[model samples]
Target: MKSGEWDRGRFVGVELQGKTLGVIGFGKIGRHVAHMGSGLGLEILAFDPFLAPHMAEELGVELVADLGDLASRCDYLTVHVPKTEGTSALIGADVLSRAREGLRVINCARGGIVDEAALLEAIESGRVAGAALDVFEEEPPTNRELVDHPAVVVTPHLGASTREAQVNVAVSAAQLVVDYLQHGKLHSPVNAVFLEPDLRERLDPYGELGRRLGCLHAQFLEGNPKRIIVKYFGDIFDEPQSRNFVTAKVLAGFLGDRCSQPVNQVNARSLARDQGLAVEEASEGRSRYFANMIRVELTDSSGERNLGGSIRGRKGIRLVSLDNYHFDAVLEGQMVISANEDRPGMIGTIGQVLSSHEMNISSMSLGRDRSGGTALSVINLDAPEIEKLAAVAEDLMQEEGILWARCLQAD
Candidate 1:
């Protein structure tokens, strides 16, 4: 119409009815899409690691066990997962190649979920019919080829740009503020808020410790988390609210900046459970080396990671044990932890590597199981870029005697 050509043939599109719509990351938005697609007579197949099978059956949706399987079956695919390490480039070349011919992709979720390059290649190769993207790997995307493609539709990340959305967001914000002020209730808080002043005072330090430990654990985490077991040792278990509060903080920290929504102490447990993560808590009155200790064991598909911490007299919070290796390392700022063979030159080797990169070590803690065996080293660095710290860890691993190294930026 704009060109005054009136080419009716060019405007013809395929009907969505009776087509299989694959919903990846079946969270709230994905579920809504599935519901609407079902209304349109489309068969909905959802793939979410966290979603329960019964819930899918109840909604008249088939639960797909694998992403590849969903891709192979669906005529159209839409992603709705958070962009974390596991989800980044989820719909890459391999997944797209496995998808049914003429599969149309849609992404209104986060950027980087569907690999742009792969999608572009797929569209050009006729593997994918087209793509409807509301998000991109980069905002104001530089990929002009994809943007200019006649078969593709692009939006400037405006999924929540409606007038109703604007009004609802404003109302929600005002309501949250009012509720907090009048009723002392928080609906969605970015930070942890303790209602009772006395409780906050008593548990603030331990909560911080728990959060730090969680953060550290998250940095070391591999694969999808299945369960979080929090064990409280010593006098900290005396307070009735201690167990719940600290556990929440731990979950909050572990999930920091990983979830689609902001996670806080109030909603952390629920959010974890929603993602199919089982949360377990245990308490003991007896002391284990410290007056109070919060031990968290995160079990994931890869394996289990154990992290234990305690609030020392004046040290504030210290990470006491990691995977059974005992050491007193302050859980703050930029730090590098490594497992290596017990030797005289191991510490010096790490120091030399850091020195080569102009990275200064502020503090260092070393722990070993036996006189001549595997050892763990936790080194605090004077603020380096996270990327640089990761690079240093990689470099450390390449050195002699070092088995593995990991960088942690704990807040």
Candidate 2:
């Protein structure tokens, strides 16, 4: 004990082998950290308001309902959440003050998620044993005293600076470009909003449905459009990410049909704006027909029209409603659609035309309000020639019973 710097007789340290680790956010990075801690024989507990219960169980973590419960039980705590209004100063004086003594905290997520002043108070008052801060409220922090504190360890924000991480990021960026250029696949998007993996999976079908819906409307219009409004119903309204995906696809379909140049999800919005077309969105959770649905309404000099679609369990993407007529038909392949009077021989007349042209009917569905009112007939065909389908539609429109007819080919 010559220098007297080391307390040789009273040495103490917290072992992580059997201790509890509390994770604030169960995002990608948080899950990785939890896996590492689990491998080290540490019990992992997590609190994420958005994370589902099954996800935590799958990660072998106990999901805590409250922050205070997690703070009081953990020997060590770490935060991994984005910097948002809801998460600003998430772990503050109150959380630290209520924490059990000898608790060590780590903040490597964002600067403002943890209050530095409250952390210093906890350290000084012995409420916290130590803190490892990789980020500060201010970069090159003005408060040097806190950084120099004996119980605190600081890093220069090099969290994602590893060589492997750099390579991954560069590859991801290049892949995003290649995906867009080569396949029109938007894997990694900049303008597209972020969504949880589960939510994305659930909403994938709707994106396709939205594109087809828009295409159907555009084909039906065959003229200049004044305005387009997209409506979301049921749980789809809760997810903001779905808005971008659906709207982008809708624009892609509509513009791709009308524009001479190729239109995709990335460039659809700009194209819509350049064409002096008004784009709007609305959402309502209430739906009398289905749990979730997307409707696209188009207004032009001619009139107003609406097309609606939804994802049904095993049925896949279905065109649920077109204007006042409601029908369930898969929006795929070559389709000949006709709006006509609810005549008894309407289906026979359409079938006779296809039979005479040697075009096989893949599937056909008819929808109408009543036996004597207006009706809609969607006939999927093996017919590929646009002229042949157009001839059939033209023939139907010329008939006394048919009001309007259109040929839509899906590419």
Candidate 3:
């Protein structure tokens, strides 16, 4: 059964217990469904090429690298991949064409991934005995003929709708794609610290630090952060944008992910200065590490907080502030990794893995998804284990298979 399907409290085949739940797009709700389904004692198998193999192993799930492989192996194949340009109509006739007998299919992701017409044919032929869908390729797929079928169970998209579910999903995870988007999603990063080398070089040492920390704090903002104000201090004003221009540029560029176009150092500052913040301020760094610091005053949908930080070293960017929460971290390959459903021994699992590699965590941010889901955590570590970190991130993303995307925290 799909995650939304489970909480919806609609259909429960007592016979459904102990059945395998094959999922595509290991994301938020997908993971929720898998976790919740454990009461059924069902084996969880999934297919998601974008996910790393190690992450899957920890979930104790069987990972199928390819879609066809998942279909061939699963007792019930449920899809949760997104509805991107490439994913539209992904599992058309070709995918449905191959199947073992009595294969059940569920589509709680986007509607387009499965070929509706072909699915009906499979249902009629007994290749697929039952099917469930929450979304359609077309919002409210007008094709009553397909939706009205007896073998197919349908619902409007309701993945993270419950009050309890809402709070669980919106927690401290960097990307709440599943709780926010509801369905299969990629555990992708927001590219918070990406900029051209020349452009990055142009930013002052302190400004670079501000950019990284500012970007990191900005990543987990629950609601929209409409307005931002950046300010510089001390003798760092030797550059051309030392005035209002430099401040605006970083804020604008940082805000780029929410928008499509590039935000530059030129008008970026001015645009932010005029945002919704009733008041915003920037400050100087007083630490022994640097002469000054950058401070941003902003307002989000929820509440407001003052953000400050400074950078050190010749090339690498480090996190120097988290709203007065004292911590120092470099902005290179270093990562802020987190996981929830933090059961009694959840931390032990990730710790065991990190310990095996001798990786050291510089800092950590701990949180919980909800009452029952699990705990969420963020880890700041040295950049020594590059491939190892990437492997862990990939594994987490792949293992969930569109359920929860392992958001790689950065600054």
Please provide, for model 2 over 10-129, each residue's C-alpha lDDT reduced to its tens digit, 9 standing for 90 to 100: 667667899999998776678889999999999999986444455556667888877888899999999987775457889999889889788999999889889998888899999899
Which lDDT tens digits does candidate 1 get at residues 356-394? 889988989989898889999998999987668778988
> How much does candidate 2 score in TM-score?
0.52
Best by lDDT: 1
- What's the lDDT for candidate 1? 0.84
Error at 329, model 3, angstroms? 38
Q: What is the C-alpha RMSD of each candidate to the true structure, in Å?
A: 4.8, 21.9, 18.1
Candidate 1 runs further than 4 Å off: 1-26, 34-77, 82-105, 111-129, 136-146, 161-198
What TM-score does model 3 achieve against the real structure? 0.41
Superposed Cα deviation of residue 46, candidate 3 (Å): 1.2
* lDDT comparing candidate 2 with the true structure: 0.80
**Once superposed on the true structure, which residue ranges of model 3 sit more than 4 Å away at CA?**
1-14, 165-198, 201-411
RMSD of 1: 4.8
Tell me the whole-model lDDT of each prediction, alpha carbons only.
0.84, 0.80, 0.59
